[model samples]
Target chain A: MTEFEEIKKTLLTIYPFSEEHLKIFTDKLSLKEIKKKDFLLKQNQICNHIAFIIRGSFRLYQKTEQNELTIQFFTEKNWVSDLESLMLKQPSKNYIEANENSKIATISLLDIHNLMEIDSSFSMLNSLIANLTFPTTQISTLKLKSPDKRYEHLLLNNPDWINRFPQMQIASYLGITPETLSRVRARIN
Target chain B: MTEFEEIKKTLLTIYPFSEEHLKIFTDKLSLKEIKKKDFLLKQNQICNHIAFIIRGSFRLYQKTEQNELTIQFFTEKNWVSDLESLMLKQPSKNYIEANENSKIATISLLDIHNLMEIDSSFSMLNSLIANLTFPTTQISTLKLKSPDKRYEHLLLNNPDWINRFPQMQIASYLGITPETLSRVRARIN
Candidate 1:
C-alpha cells in the first residue's frame, strides 16, 4: 500500500471517519520529501507543523555543552513534532532531523485548529496525537540510574527505535557518553 | 464562588452547555475532602480518577531507593491524575498527595468516556485537559545544567508552586539534592 493509503488507514482506525470528511481533512495536508541529516525543525525556531512519517524516520535531539541528547525518534506510521512549541507558539530547544529519506504529511497548528473546527472526529484525532507526544516525557529517565538499565529497557520496550537510529544516537538517548555506551555494549556481549 | 461554581464557570467558558447538559456532566463528579499529605494516588495502583483541585493543592512524586522525588505540583483550578497510567490501564509509578485540606471534584475514566458519548462539549473539554497534562513533560529540563538554573526557571515560571511546597520537594522536582538546593538558595539570598 502507498504511504498515503497507510495514512488514511491509520486515520480510519483512529476513528471510523467518513471518507468524505476524511478527504476534506486530509486534503489540507502538505506532503514533503526529506533527505537524511536535513532538519525538519531547528532549535530557536517556533515549530509550526506536525508531521506523520509515511516512508522513513526522524530523530529529535538537544545539544548540550557536553553532548547531544536524543529526546525522541519517529518512524513510519508515527507522528513527530515539537508539540509544546507548536501549541505555545514559542521557540524550540531541540532539532528534529530526517534519519532517512522520508515522506511525511505535514499540517500547521492553524490547519489543525481549522480541521478541529470542521469536525468532531478531527478534534478527537487531534487529542489522540496530543496523547502520543506526551508518553515520552511522562515516565522513566529520572528514575533509571544506569545506562545499562535504560539500554535494556529500550531493548525490551522499543527495540525498533534502537535498530533504526545509529548507536551514537542511542547512546545519547540513554544519557551516557559514547565511550561509556561502548563499554556497556562490550559488557553485554 | 464555591469550588463547584468555579468548575461550572470554567466548563461553561470552555464550551457553552445547556443547563440539562451541565446537569448530566456535573452529576458524574463527586466531591472529595482530603487532609494535608493524604495520598490521592499510590504507586503500583491503577489511577482510576482525575480530580480537579477545588480549594487546595497537591503534589505528585515518585519514591526511589535514593529518596522520594517530587515530580509535579497542582493547585486549585488545576486537574491532577497519573494520566498516562489512567489511559493505559496500567500500574502507576508515582504518588499524588494533597498538600492542603483540599476539596476536589473527582470523576472516573469510565465517567469521562460516558460524558464524551453525551456531548461534543465534553469531548472538547477532554482535549483541552489532555493538552494540559503534556506541557510539563515537553521541554528544557534535561538541557538545563545547574540546579540554580532549574530553580530560577521555577522561580520565574512556577513561583506559586515553589512557595506552596516544601524546599526538599522543590529540590527533588529540579532533580537536585536538598543540600545543593540549600546552598543554591543561600547563594541567591
Candidate 2:
C-alpha cells in the first residue's frame, strides 16, 4: 500500500497501539530516499536514528586496514540502526550502506525517548523488537557453523538474502572467502 | 548487603521503579546457588528463566563435535539467559554453566509476562534492560577485531575476566587457541 503502511503493520504486529498513539508514533517518523552505495552511517559517527526499510536493502559492515567485513544485511520491512551508538550516544565503529536505491522511515533517538515518556507502550514495543532481533544469539551460533551449514541455513531461512545481494557481499557476511562460498554453493547444488 | 540488593540497585540504575513496584519485582525473584560446573541451562532445553548473578560467574557456550565455544560471560550483577529461547518459547542450542559456585536470582518468563500485565513499568523496565544489554552490537564488532586487539579491548573493559577465568576458557571466548592467547598476552605485557 503506502510507504508507512508496512512499518505500521510491523509495529502493530509487535504491539497493538491505540489509533491515537499509532498516529503520534508515525507523525514523528520522517522519510528519506538514498541511492545505492550511499552511506546511512559511517565509522566514528553517532547513529541518532533508527530506520525501517521501506524499500530495497542495506549492508552493515566495518572496514579494516585490508578488507571490508559485512556483519548483517537488512531488506524491506527490516529495521536498521547501530543500536550501540543510538542507545549509548557514542560514535559507531561500523558502516550502514544502501545495497540499492532505498526508502526508509526513520525516527531519531530523542523522538523515541520522548515517545517512551509519552506512553509506556512505546517502551514495551522497543523491548519486544530488541528481543526479536537479538543478534548475539544468532550470530554467535552462526560464527561456529561450518561454511556449508551456514549457507544452507541462510538458504532455508532468508533465501532473498542469497538471491538479492551479490555473492561477494554474501560471502563477506557469511565470514567466508568468495572461493569458499563458491565451493559451498557448488556442493549444495 | 542482601543477595537481591545488588539486583535491586541494578534495576533502579536502569529505570527508577517506585518502591511498591520494586518490592513486587524482588518478591517474585527466587534465589538459587549453583555449584561449580553446574548447568543453569543445557542444549535442547528451553530456558524459562532469566537469572541475575548475585555472586560468582557463568559462561554461555555451545558445544560442537570438536570444541565448546564460549559465546559470553556473566559475572556479578550481570544477567544471564538464552534470551532467544526465553522470548520465543523454543528449545535453546546453547548451555549456560557456572564457572564457579555461584548465586543467582531468577524470574520465570511466565512471571515476567504476568508482571508486564500488572504494570506497564515492568514492560518498560524489560525494554530498557534489553536495550542496555544489546549483545549483538558488541559481539558483531568484536568478531572482526584481531586477537591482540580483542584481548586488549577485554583487558580494558573487563579485566576481571582475564584475572578470574581459566586461560583456556578465555581463549575459547576470544575464538582463539590457548597458544594464540598466550602470544597475545605476552606481546601486550
Candidate 3:
C-alpha cells in the first residue's frame, strides 16, 4: 500500500473509519517534504495546520524568556500538532521543526471540522487526537512527577533518545538541568 | 434538562452523538455520593472506574517518601480518572479523594469500552480527560521552565485559586515550596 493508503489504514486501525470517511481526509490533506532544520511551524505564528509525519524526525519546543525547552519529539508514523494553539487559532508559543529532512501530510483545522460534520466516523477521529495527545503528555508528566524514576525508566526504555538528542534538550524535556542529568547518568552507570 | 442531559449535551457539543450513543453512556453509569475527605479511589488498588463530579470538589495525589504531592484537583462538572492506572488496569500509584462532600457519577472501564464499541462518539469523551488533568501539570511544567512568568500569569488568570487551595498544595502543584509561594505572592501583591 502507498503512504496515503497507509495513512488511512493507520488512522482507521486506531479509529474505525469507512472508505468514504478516509476519502474525506485524503481529499483535504496535502503531502509535503521538509528539509533538515526547516520549520514545519514556528513560535509566535498561528498553527492552522496539523501535520502527521509519514517519515523523518521533528521536535516541538517552546522558547521562554529564560531559554528554549523541548516539549516533545516526533518521528515516523506520528502526528505532531500544537493542539492548544491550533484549536484556539492563536499564535503558537511553540515551534515544531524538522530534525532530519522529512516528509509529512497535513490537514487544516477547517477541513477537520468539515470532515467531522460530514462523516460520523470523524467523531472517532477526534478521540484519536485525544488519545494520541494524552499519552504523549502523560509520559512526560509521569516523568516530571518523579524525575529520578523517570531518568532510570528512560534509560531502560529508550536509551536511543539519550544518544539522539542533545543533553541540554533532553534535560529540558526531562524538566531537569544538564548538570542534574549528567549526575544522574553517572550515578546509574 | 437533567444532569445526565447536560452531560450528554456537553458530549455532543464536542462530538455529535445519536440517541443510541447517549443511551449507552447513561445505561452504564450510576450516580454516587461521596462525603468530604472520603476516598473516591485509593493508592495500590486497581482503578476500576472513572468518576465525573456533578457537585463538590476532589483531589488526586501521590505520597512521596517525604511528603504527599497533589497531582490534580477537580471541582464541580469535572471528570477524574487515573489515566495511567486506568489504561493499564494496574494497581494505582495515586489516590483520588473528595475535597468536599460530593455527588459523582461513575462508569466502569469495561462499560466505557463497551460504549466505545457501540458508538464512536465516546472517543471525544476520552479526549476530554486532559481538559481536567493537563492544566495543573502544564502550569507546573511552565513554572519549572519559566517560574516568574507562569507565576505572574497564574495570579493574573486565577487570583481566586490562591484563596481556594491551601498554600502548601498550591506550592506543591507549582513545583515550589510554601515559603517560596509566600514570597511570590508577596511580590505579586
Q: Write model 3 residue lDDT over A75-143, tens digit each, in one string.
A: 777778876666545687778888889999988866775665565456555544544454333433542
For A1-189, candidate 2 gives per-residue lDDT tens digits of: 387777778878767888788888889989899999999999999988888899989998888788887878888888888866765567988899999999998888678767766665676455434533667545554556588888987888789898899999888777778999999999999
> Could you tell me how far off, in angstroms, the CA of residue B65 lies in candidate 3 after the best superposition?
5.6
The numbered model that scores best in DockQ is 2
Which pairs clash in the backbone of model 2? none
* Ten-residue region with minimum lDDT total, candidate 1 chain B: B135-144
Worst 10 residues of 3 chain A by lDDT: A134-143
Cα lDDT, model 1, residue A110: 69
For candidate 1, write residues B49-97 as lDDT tens digits.
8888888999888887878867678889877888767765679888899
TM-score of 2: 0.80
Clashes of each: 0, 0, 0
Candidate 3 local lDDT, residue B10: 58
Order of candidates by lDDT, top first? 2, 1, 3
Worst 10 residues of 2 chain A by lDDT: A124-133
Candidate 1 lDDT for residue A145: 42
Cα deviation of B4 in candidate 3 (Å)? Answer: 8.2
Alpha carbon deviation, residue B180, candidate 1 (Å):
4.2
**Over the stretch A46-150, how does candidate 1's per-residue lDDT look in tens digits?**
998879888899988887787777777888887789876765567988899999999889878767666665555565565445545654332345434477877
Query: What's model 2's interface RMSD, roughly to a tenth of an angstrom?
Result: 4.1
Which has the greatest TM-score? 2
Residue B34 in candidate 2 has what lDDT? 99
